[model samples]
Target: MTRVLLLGGTGDALAIARALPTTHVYSLAGLGRVPGDLACTVRVGGFGGIDGLVRYLRDEHITLVVDATHPYAAQMSRHAFDACALADVPLWAVRRPAWQPQAGDDWREASDWREIVECIAPFHRPLFTLGREALAHLHDIPASQHWTIRCLDAHPGNARASIVDARGPFDLAGERALFDAARIDVVVSKNSGGRATEAKLAVARERGIAVVMLTRPALPDADRIFDDAASARDALQHWLTRP
Candidate 1:
């Protein structure tokens, strides 16, 4: 009986958890609302660090690990890589495909948050769709620049005056309404390519607003990499069936 440890925090993670064997345990970082009941046992919160994860894996006899977290969740992925290696447990990563710029999409790629902050001075009325964790990098933005920031939770930060507490699955019409209402001059967003939040990019293209897109941080190489939920589930099943 190979007990599994699953790192989950996204829609893909949920889907994978649902598909996992009953002996597996699902874990979340406990950042957002507690997820609905998963198919397997669920645990929320951090695993301390590499040492903590290694201990848990050994103690619980976890034979396999699935890293199905957000692409931006580089720290957790790194920890999982190291911990699983130390514990001699197999690990897999499931990544959603990133959004590529299409024709007519005015995308300016920034290597990181520092670069975006440095080059974004010209765009005064900016709309920030970057997640809350990345907001700290924009603290240096000049106070003169009025920013429209959106997040799932209310962020009490001094860098931005306008903060909208909202979650997405945002439609084109809603994005258009937000852009028009905000009178946005530019858009700054992470290349977190998924259907849940791509509407703003469409609206930006439609309005001719410049977009400063931040590239995703690199993740450690995994024993396996999957681009979709179905493929990942199949791979996990194969691994489970092996001696």
Candidate 2:
């Protein structure tokens, strides 16, 4: 039987975990509340580094590695690639596609925090949807710029901007209301490309607010890459059954 180790964080990770056979083990970075009940064996927290991961794979006799981490989890993904190669285990990734701009979208593309900070300089009230992990890199942005930041977790009390602790699946009407309330003049976000957090882009276009959009980091090469759970499941079935 093919013993599988799934690196999980997103909904796709959980979905794939549920679909795979009983030999699978699901692991998370334990960044948030240890998510609700999952079907397979669960392990949480970081695996030290590439050395630790390679050791774990060998010790556990894992035959396959599935990377279903969040799009921005480039470090973890790179580690997985290196570790799996060292361990001689096949690896695959499930990467959600990035969002493309539509007509009327007023966007300024940026590659990193420095670029994003520069992009927002002309605007007064800049709303940052870059999440808690990426927020620290923006210290260079002048204190004179009034900022509004949103994340799933609470701010650390030292934050200079107004922070909103919330999760999303945000809609256009609600996002518009949020922008009005915050008096947001410009928006900054990563191009995570999912329906849940996409409302702000539409609202920004409607309001003619400029958006500083950060592109996703380049993905590490994998044996196979699937954008959805069904396709990943089909590929897994074939691999697991192959002679």
Candidate 3:
């Protein structure tokens, strides 16, 4: 019998997870919310490391591995790649495309947060969609700047920064309201290309605010890579029927 292991955390992962058979396993790192509704078995927490993951793949008899993690989750994705290769099981990745800058957008690519701070020097109010990574830099905030960070986890912001705990699939109107209310003059975001959380980019364009985009980290190659969840699910279904 064919068994699947889904390495998931993003919304794309949830979509693919929904189509999984009861025998397959869906794994989460216990970051945000664990869905109480997945028909497939849900495993929380890490697999220790590459050695541990290899043991799990063989022990669970997982024939195939699907990586539907976030684009920036390079470490987890790397572990999956190595573990699958060691276990001699095929690995497929749901690798979403990165966003491209459109007309009227003032976009600057930053290699890291230090570069981001330098690029955002001219802006007074900056909206950070880079999640909790921004929270670490609250103490570094300049006297002339105010920071707004949006993340899945809720935290009472410090004196210089405000944290907006919310999930995505955000609409343009709401993004506009957020920008207006925050008096945003710039945005800091990762180039995570998806409809969810993309409204902020559109709003940035509309308001003519500069965006400091974080460059995506390099990911290890997989046996197969799917750009979308639906296609990955379809391919997995086909794999299940293979002799």
Structural similarity to truth (TM-score) of each candidate: 0.89, 0.89, 0.97
Error of 1 at 93 (Å): 0.7
**Taking the tens digit of each residue's C-alpha lDDT, what string does model 1 give over 1-243?**
788898987777888888775678999998766656666888999998999999999999998899999888999999999999999999999988899887678888888767887767887878888768446655666876878888778876564557888877899999888888878888889887778899988888877788998888999999999997779988887878898
Across 31-95, the per-residue lDDT of candidate 2 in tens digits comes to 65565576678889899999999999999999999999989999999999999999999999998
- Over the stretch 1-243, how does candidate 3's per-residue lDDT look in tens digits? 899999999999999889887999999998999988889999999999999999999999998899999999999999999999888999999999999999999999999988998999988999999878988888889999999999999998888899999998899999989998999999999989989988998998987888999999999999899999989989888887778
Steric clash pairs (candidate 1) = none
Q: What is the Cα-based lDDT of residue 106 in candidate 2? A: 87
Q: Can you give the lDDT of residue 191 in candidate 2?
A: 89
lDDT against the true structure, per candidate, is: 0.84, 0.85, 0.92
Which residue pairs come into collision in candidate 3?
Answer: none
Q: Give the RMSD in angstroms, all C-alphas superposed, for model 1.
A: 2.4
**What global local distance difference test value does model 1 have?**
0.84
Q: Which stretches of candidate 1 lie over 4 Å from their true place?
A: 134-143, 156-160, 237-243
Which structure is stronger by lDDT: 1 or 2?
A: 2
Ranking of all predicted structures according to lDDT, beginning with the best and ending with the worst: 3, 2, 1
